[model samples]
Target: MTKRKNNNKLELIVAFSWVLEKVCDSEFSLLLPLSFFIIEFVIAIFLFFQFSKEEEEGVEVAAEEVSEEYTFQHTLAGKLWTENSFNSTAFKSTILNAWKLKNPVEIQDLSKNLFLFKFSMKRDLEYILRSGPWSFYRALLVLERVTGEEQPSDLTMHFDTFWVRIYELPLMLLSEVIAKKLGNIFGSYEEMDLKDAHRIGTFLRIKVTIDLRNPLKRGTVVKFKEKNRRDHFKYERLPTFCFIYGRIRHQLKDCEAFEDLNEEGFEDIEEQELSYGQWLRASPLPKVIEDQKKRDSSSGTCSKNIFNVSSGQSRCKTKEK
Candidate 1:
C-alpha cells in the first residue's frame, strides 16, 4: 500500500512538472519567479519524504542487528548478594571449577558482581540450576536462567533455590502432595526428596526456590483433620541475611528496617530483639556423601540429575546457566 502511494505521488509530481515546464516555456514569463518558488517547494517536499523512507529502513535494519547480538540462549545470569567487591578473576576461575562442565562455557561480567554464564549445552545449563543455590566468598550467588531480551544488569535476582527441610510432620502427611503444599508457602516448590520415603527421618527435605526480598518464614502451624501441629524450617546453604528483616539480601547492620527502627528511638531495644537467629542456618551436609547415598538408595525412583530444579515448574521467575 505504501509503495502504491509513493507511485501515485511520483506520477502526480511528474505531471505537475510537465505542466509547469509548459507554462514557463510559454508567454506566462511574468509568473517565472512564482513558478520557481512552486517548483522548489515541490522538490523539497519530495526529497523530505524520500530521505525519511530510507532513514526508516536503516533504523529497522539496525534494530534487527541489535536484537540478534543481545539474544541469548542456554544462558544463566547471576548476581552476588553483597555490598563488598569481589575479585573477578577469582570469581570466574572458581565458578568454572565449580561447574565442571564437559564443554567449555563463557563467563562474562555484566556489572559489579553481576555475571553471565553462557552454556554450550542445555544439559550443562540444567545441571547448574538444579544443583544451586551456589555461593562465592560466603555471599549468596543468585542464579536465573536467561530468557527473552533482558539485560543482565536489569535482571532482578532476589530468589535462589534451596533444600528446605520441614521438621515435625506426622507420618500420614509425609507425602509429595503435602511437601508441595508446604514448599509453596515458603516460595516456589521445585522437588521433594523421596529417596527415604519409607524411613521417617528428623525432617522432610524439599527443594524450594525462595525469594530473598522477603524474610525467611520461621514456621507455620499445620491443621490436619482438626489436629494442630507446628513445623519448623531450616534452609541448607543459606547465605548472609538481615536478622532484623529475616531477609537474605543484607545483614542486620545494613538492613533498612533496622535504620527505620533506629530513627524511631528503638535502637537499643531493637538491638536485643533480633527476630531471626543462627538456628535458621542449616548444618552443612557433605555433597559427595549425599550424592553417594542418593545413588545407592533403592526405595524410590528419582531424577538422575543431582540438581532437583525444573525451570518450567519453578515458583521463582529467575534464570541461571
Candidate 2:
C-alpha cells in the first residue's frame, strides 16, 4: 500500500508541470505578433514622411523655375517700353538696368564666348529695329544687354539701303546669283598664294571680287575673252555694290589681259574708254588675220612697199615706165 501511494504522487507532479509549460508558450506566441505589428507601423510612418518631404521639394523647384521664366519675360517687356521713348538716355538706362539684373554665374561662365555672340546678336537686333515698325527690337535689345554687346550705329540706314537694292534686283536672278556666289566663297580649294595670278586661274572658273555692301545698278555688263575666240559677257541687273566696285588685278590698278581698258584715249584714237555700252558693241576679229592686219596698219608706207615687191615677184615684170 505504501509503494502505490508514492507512484501516484510522482505522476500528479509531472502532469501539472506539462500544463504550466503549454500556457507559457501560448502567451509568448501572442506577444510576438503584436511586436511585429508595431515595428511595421513605425516603418510605414517613416516612409510616408520621407515621400512627403520629396514632393514638397519638387514643388518648390518647379515654382523657382517658373519664377525665373516670368522674370525674363518681364525684363523683356520693360526694355520694349523703354525703346518706345526713342531717347538715347532712356535706351542706355534700360540697357544698364538689364545688365545689373543678369545672372552673375552665367556672365562669369560664358564671358569669353559671349563676346562675339553678343556682338552678332546686337547687330542683328539693330538691323531688325531699323527694318520696320516691329516692336521686337526691345526684346532683342534686352537680350543683347544681358549678353553684353553694343548695338551697331546707323543700323537702320544700312538695313534700309540693303533691302532697297535687293528689291530692285530681279528676284529669281538675284537668288540664283547670290546662292552661286555664296557657294563659291565657302567651297574648298587647293592651297594657293594670294599674290600668284597663275595659281588663281588654276582653281577659279570665274575670278572676281564682289562687294556685298553696294550692289550694281541695272543695265551693266562685264565682258572677258576666252582662248577659243569667244566673248563672255555677264549682264548685271541691279547687281550688288561688290559687282560694280570690286576690281580683279594682278597688281593695284593693273587689270589682267585688258589693262589697256583702264587707260585714257589720249595715247591712241582707236583705243576708246571701255564702258558697258562699248563692250557690248565691240566685235571679235579672225585670229589668223588679226595680227597681220594690226602689223599693216601700224607700218603704213613700209607695208605698202612690201606688198608691191611681193606682187612684182609673182608677175616677173620689168618696170621701166
Candidate 3:
C-alpha cells in the first residue's frame, strides 16, 4: 500500500511540471510580440519629435532673415524726398523745386528712362511728407531715380518755406497754368490734393521747380495772392471776359452766372448707362401698383364727369322738346 501511494505522488509531480512549462511558454509568446510593438512605437515617437524640432528651427531662421533683409532695404529719406506731399503747399513746393533742380538732365532726356525715376522720387517724397516718418523707409525702397544713399546728399531734410510776393499778374497766374502744363507734359503725374487751394499751390510749386530748376537762384521767395484771381474785378473788364468769367466761376464754386446757364436742371443729373436693355428692369413693384391705383382713381373721376355732362345734355334736349 505504501509503495502504491508513493508511485501515485510521483505521477502527480510529473503532471504539475508539464502544466507549469506550458503556462510559461504561453506567457513568453504573448510578451515577445508586445515587446516588439513597444520598440517600434518608441522609435516612431522619437523620429516625430526630431522632425518637428528641425522644422521649428528652420521657420525661426527664415523669419529672422526676412526681418533683417527688410531693415537693410527700407530707408526713411526716400519717402520724404520722393513721394508727393499733402500737408503744407509751401512745403511741397520747396521739396519739388529741390528735386527738379537736382534732376534736370533726366527731365530734358526724351528717352524717358530717367523720367520714370524722377517721377518716382517725386511721388516718394510726397508720400513721406503726407504719411510722416513711418512710411519714410518704405517709400525709399520704391524710389527709382534716387537711391537711399543719395537722398541725404540731395535733400535739405527739413521743412522750411520762404514766402515772397510777386507784382507781375502773369507770374502770379504762372504757377497754376504751369502746373497744368507740367502735368500734361508728364503723363505719369497725378494731382492728389483735393482742396482747390492746396491743389493749386502744390501744382504751382511743381511748375516753378520745372521752369526754374534752381528756385533759390530764381529767388526762393514767392508771393502768391491771398485771394485768387476771381476776387479781382478787373478780370471781368477784359474783352475775353466771358472765358475768364467762366473759369473763375468754376473755381469759386458759387457763380450766379453759372447757375443761370444751367437752367435746364442738368447740372445735378445722375447718368446711368446700360450696355443692354432688359425687358424687365428692377424697380419697386409696390410703387408701380400704388401709381396705377392713383391713375385709376383719376380716370374714375373723369368718367363720372363725362356721364354727368351727357345726362345733363339729354335732360336739356327733353326740356327743349
Candidate 4:
C-alpha cells in the first residue's frame, strides 16, 4: 500500500510539469505578435508629426517672401495700351501735359511697348491711369492700369474679342431677332455676326461667344419661344480660329484670308445689321478694310499668309489636302 501511494504522487507531479510548459509556450506566442504591432504603431506616429512640421516651415518661408514684395510693388507699377508706337519721351510729355504730376521723376522706358512706366508718387500713378483713353493720331488707348511687375508685361493674358458660330436659323432673319436670341443664351456679347451659308440649302448661321471655359459640347440645344410655340436651335464650337491661319493674335475674320469680310458684314454694336442679301454681301473688300490693311502694314502687323478662296486658292488647303 505504501509503494502504490508513492507511484500515484509521482504521476501527479509529471502531469503538472507538462501543463506548465504548454502555458508558457502559449503566452510567448501572443506576446511576440503584440510587441511587433506596438513598435509599428509608434513608428507611424513619429513620421506623421515629422511631415506636419516640415509643411508648417515651408508656409512660413513663403509668407515672409510675399510680405517683403508687397510694399514696393504697387508704387513701382504702371501699364499702358495704345495703337501708337511706344516712345518714352513722347509718353512722359503727354502725361505731363495732360495731368497733375507729383515729383514727376524722369521716366524709364520699361518696354518698347509702353507696358510699364516708372512713377514717384501714388497719386500720379492713379491720376495717369484714370486720365481718359489718351489718343494719338486716330488711335485710342485700350488699356491702362497699375501693375506690379518689374519687367514690362500685359496685365492680363487674353484676347479682347473672340468669334463663335450659331447653327441653323431662318433665312435672312432680322438682326434684332438674332440679338434677342443671342442675348438669351450668352451674356454680354459684342455684336451679332452673320455668315451667308455658302454651303447648299443653308441660308444663314448665328454664332455666340463662349469665353474662358470649355465650349458647349456638340449638339447642345437652345430653345427660343415664339407665340406659345418652341423652336430649338442647336449650336457647337467653331474650330480654334488660329488653327486655320496657323498663327496667333488674329481670329478668322481679322485674318487676311477674310479680307473679303467687310465691316458691313458685321452688325454694328450701336446698330445691328438691318438689311438682307445685298446687306449681307460686302462690296469687294471695302475701303475701311483696305485702310485697316494699310495701317497694319505700317505697324508691321500683316497676316503672314492668305488662305481664302478669293486669293484664287489657299496655300493652307493645298498643303493639308
Candidate 5:
C-alpha cells in the first residue's frame, strides 16, 4: 500500500510539471493546454516551410536579374567576349578610333563575353558592321549589329566564295575579265596566290556576299561566257586564309612548284587597264595571240624559214639548245 502511494505521488509531480510548461492558467482544462501545444507546433512548421520557399524564390530572382543585365548590355557576342580579357572602355576607345565613331552615348558589358555600344547615330552602327571581321591578339572577333529591336530577329549576312583558277591567262588580264563579267554578282574579289602558277594559270579568291533578300541564296549557280565557251561555277566557303603563313590555307603558296620559277626571273608583267565597256566589246584573246605571235617571231625564229613538217622537212633550222 505504501509503495503504491509513492508511485502515485511521482505521477502527480510529472503531470504538474507538464501543465506548468503548457499554460499559466491552472483553472483551465488540461485538454486546452494540449491543444495549445499542437497549435504552436503547427505554426512553427508553417514558418519553416515559408522560409525555405522564400529562399528558393530569392535565388531564382537573382539568376533572372543577372541574365537580364547581360542581355540589356551586349550587342555583340563572340570568343573574345567569353574570355573577359577586355572591358567596355577598351572596346569603346578602339572602335571609336578605328571606325571614327562619334558620340557613343554608352558602352556596357553584356554577359561574360559580349559588349554593347549605344550610339544615337544610325550611321555609327553601320560603320561598325562595315568595319568588322576584326582580329584581336590573333583571335577573330565576330560582331552582330543589332538593329535596336526589342526581340532578337534574323540579322546575319550570308556570303559564299569560290577559288577560281584561270589557265593560260595572266593574273592582271584575267582579274579584269572576272571583275567585269562578275561585277553584278561578285561583291568582292581577292587575288589568292595559294600556289605557284604553272607559268600560265592565275589563281584568285573570289567571295560573293549575297543579299538574303535575293533568290540567289537558294543554291543558284553562276554562269558566264569566256573564250566562246559557256562556263558555270559554284561558290564555296574555302578555308583559304592561312593565319600563320599569310597565304591561302589549302593552296599552300609555298609549295615546291614555285621554287624553280623563283630562281629563273620572269618578265616584267604589266597590267592592262581596260574599262568595263571595253571588256564587253569582244574577245581579248585575239589581241593576246597577236602579241604572242609578234614575240615568237622576233625571238623564236618564227619568221625564219625553219624546216617543219608543215613546210618541207628540209634543212635543220633548230637553234643550239
Candidate 6:
C-alpha cells in the first residue's frame, strides 16, 4: 500500500515536470502573464516537497515492517569454508536433504559462499546449530546463530561447536571438573556427559567451541604423581580438515603448505608424513543409543533409562500397563 502511494506521488512529479517543460519550451508561453508562470512554479514546488516528505515516511514504515517480519531470532549466519564458488541451488537442495528439517527453512544466499538460514521454528534452528558443524561437498559450513544488531557479513564464523571426545584419561580423573579442564584445552567447554565419569567408556564426550583458524589440537600431555601421560583427542562428526596443516578450514590438497612443499622439491611426501590423520575423528555412538535418540525425538519424550552411578549400570524404568 505504501509503495503504491509512493509510486503515485512519483508519477505526479513526472507529470508536473513534463507539463512545466512543455510550457517553457512552447512558443505560446510568451503570451502568458508573469503571475501565471510564478503560480505554476509554486504549485510544483509545493507538490515536490510534499512528495519528498511522504516518500521519506514511507521508507521508514517499510523498514519497520521488514524489521518486524524478520526478527532473526531463529536465524543462522553461515559461510562455507572454501575458496571455490558454490551453486546456491545445489547447496539449498543439499541442506534440505541433509537437515530433513520439520519446519520450513528460508535460505538466503549472501554471495561469496555466505548464507542466512531463517527457520520457521526455534526448535529447528537449535537442532541444526547443535548438530553441526555441517558440510557441503566436503567444505565445512561455519555457522553462527544470529544475535543482536550484527549484519550477516559481520557475524563471526571462526568458532564452531563440536563434540570432542577425551581419550585415555585416568579413571580417577574422569569427573566433571577434570572434563571441563581438559575440554578447555581445545576451546571454550560447552557441555559434557555427566554419567561418563561413572561408566568405563572408550572416551569422555564433551562439547567445545573450536577455533577453525587454529590448528586442530591432537592431544594434551598431563602429569599425575610425577608421571606424565598423553591423552588423545577425537572430534565427532568431524568434517574435512587440512592434514598438511591440521586446520579445519580446508582440505590438504587446497592447503598452501602443500603447494610450498611441492615448490621445495618435496612433492613425494606420503600421507603418513602429514601432521594429522583420520584418527582425529571419533567413532559413532552405539547403534542402540542412536536408535533410542531417534525414538525420543519422534515421540517428543526423553524416556531413556537412568544410569545408576553407584551400581555402574543403566537402570531402565518400565512403564505400568
Local distance difference test, candidate 5: 0.38
lDDT of 4 at 108: 53
- 1-321 per-residue lDDT for model 5 (tens digits): 446444655565566558666565655555676756665565455444443333556633344345443332334432231222556466556545544433454555654434556656555455444433343432234455553443322423233222333332334444545543453454455333222232324333233343322322112233433444323333222222321222221112333443443455223211132111111111122243345445544533323121111121111122437
Candidate 2 TM-score, true structure as reference: 0.16
Give the lowest summed-lDDT range of ten residues in model 6.
Answer: 306-315
All candidates in order of lDDT, best leading: 1, 6, 4, 5, 3, 2
lDDT for 45 (candidate 4) = 58
Model 4, 40-118: lDDT tens per residue? Answer: 5654554445434345566334544565533443353333422236566776676555444436644555554444445
Question: Which candidate leads the pack in TM-score?
Answer: 6
Q: Can you give the lDDT of residue 292 in candidate 1?
A: 55
Cand. 5 TM to true fold: 0.29
Greater TM-score among 1 and 6 belongs to 6
Clashing pairs in 1: 76-320, 76-321, 130-307, 144-319, 144-320, 145-319, 145-320, 215-246
How many angstroms is residue 256 displaced in model 5 relative to the true structure, after the best TM-score fit?
A: 29
Task: Write down the TM-score of every candidate.
Answer: 0.65, 0.16, 0.18, 0.28, 0.29, 0.68
List model 2 lDDT by residue over 1-321, tens digit each: 336444654564466446545655775755555655654565455444443333556633444354332222111111221212344444444443333322221211122111111222333334322222212222222122221123433122211111111112222333334424422332322122222222222211222223323322222222224322222333211111111133211111222434444355223423233322222211222243334544434533211111111111111112224
lDDT of 3 by residue, 204-288 (tens): 3221111111112211222355643321111001111011132210211233454554555544522222111111111211243
* Worst lDDT 10-window in candidate 4: 309-318
Of 2 and 3, the candidate ahead on TM-score is 3
Q: What lDDT, from 0 to 1, does candidate 1 have?
A: 0.73
Model 3, TM vs. native: 0.18
Off by over 4 Å in 2: 1-65, 68-172, 176-321
lDDT against the true structure, each candidate: 0.73, 0.28, 0.30, 0.39, 0.38, 0.72
Which residue pairs of candidate 4 clash?
Answer: 165-207, 166-206, 166-207
lDDT of 3: 0.30
- CA RMSD for every model? 14.5, 34.5, 36.2, 22.8, 26.9, 14.7
